[model samples]
Target: MPISYTDQQIREKAASLGLIQEGADLPRQLRGKVVAAMAYGDAAERHQAPEPQLAGEIVIHGSSILIDGEHFPWLVAAQPMDIGLNPDGVSTVRLTLMAASVQVIRPEPRPESEH
Candidate 1:
């Protein structure tokens, strides 16, 4: 069964994943961040796999936002509708704005020495 999540739940999950700052309330906060929107089931499986999948980049055009070149309303993108788990068992929220499930992800933060 698909897992359902409230906006608060999704925000908590995204914060935990470091995809967004805790308490972020704007879509612009995620602007330019790399995200993957895939089929819900496929996303679940891919999250457990070793290789990562690249979908589209997020482009915020003033009052609007676009992912993979398709338009996504600010309200829908800001409020994720579902949640899933990544390989490490951490929760990843899913946005239903696209025909595919949306997974907002970022690479693990490297230590300052690596920079």
Candidate 2:
């Protein structure tokens, strides 16, 4: 059986994975940043607890995403689609987005003698 997830649950998972921002239009954002799309599945149990693992190469360019899979015709139909991970080991989807604005503060440089 497929695992059921609410919209909030899905959004929370995406946020934790760094796939989407808190209030951003996830689907629209993903579409804007897609270079390619593909269907994915797991080698392990199909109905496992966690989502399926994606075993492939996915390159994330500036607001562009690329996915490569053997059976991914749905991707072609979707053109620009939002990507998310399933916690049932059913399939895998990759995503790419614009260079986000997450700043990292660095300490100011000090003179060698100050050490």
Candidate 3:
């Protein structure tokens, strides 16, 4: 796996996307959401990976969403179970930003190596 983005990079990108106010403190838990958004080409520059890929884990904290430890206050997701989606079939969850016109997702696949 590649190294994760730094606080500065994440912050700059977040600000550029208007996800957070400039110089705002992004909680450590929301990084994953940011990454997912960026990976989905939410940035002003649309050159993110053309292919959607799984990179990190999504963690839900009360009403907060964190990715790889960075908190995303403006993003929310649909719990698979709440929507009657089978966990064993498709574990991916739909995440949406506060007012953005699109949705992004982080794919969760079983590790075949563990089998």
Each model's lDDT: 0.56, 0.49, 0.67
Worst 10 residues of 1 by lDDT: 31-40
lDDT of 3 by residue, 19-115 (tens): 7899997766777777777665644455555776563766665777676687865745444323234556644556554565756788788699966
lDDT value, residue 1 of candidate 3: 45
Ranking by TM-score: 3, 2, 1
| Model 3 residue 103 CA deviation in Å | 30
- Number of colliding residue pairs in model 3: 11
Worst 10 residues of 2 by lDDT: 32-41
**Relative to the unseen true structure, what is the C-alpha lDDT of residue 22 in candidate 1, on a scale of 0 to 100?**
92
- lDDT tens readout by residue for model 1, 1-115: 5545456755665676677789985264553232322235457886785776454455555546576688865465445345464556545445645345567699899999999
Backbone steric clashes in candidate 2, count: 10
How far is 78's C-alpha from truth in model 1 (Å)? Answer: 62
**How many angstroms is residue 19 displaced in model 3 relative to the true structure, after the best TM-score fit?**
2.0
Candidate 1 RMSD to the correct structure: 22.3
**Model 2 residue 84 lDDT?**
64
TM-score of 2: 0.24
TM-score of each: 0.24, 0.24, 0.30
How much is 46 displaced in model 1, in angstroms? 16
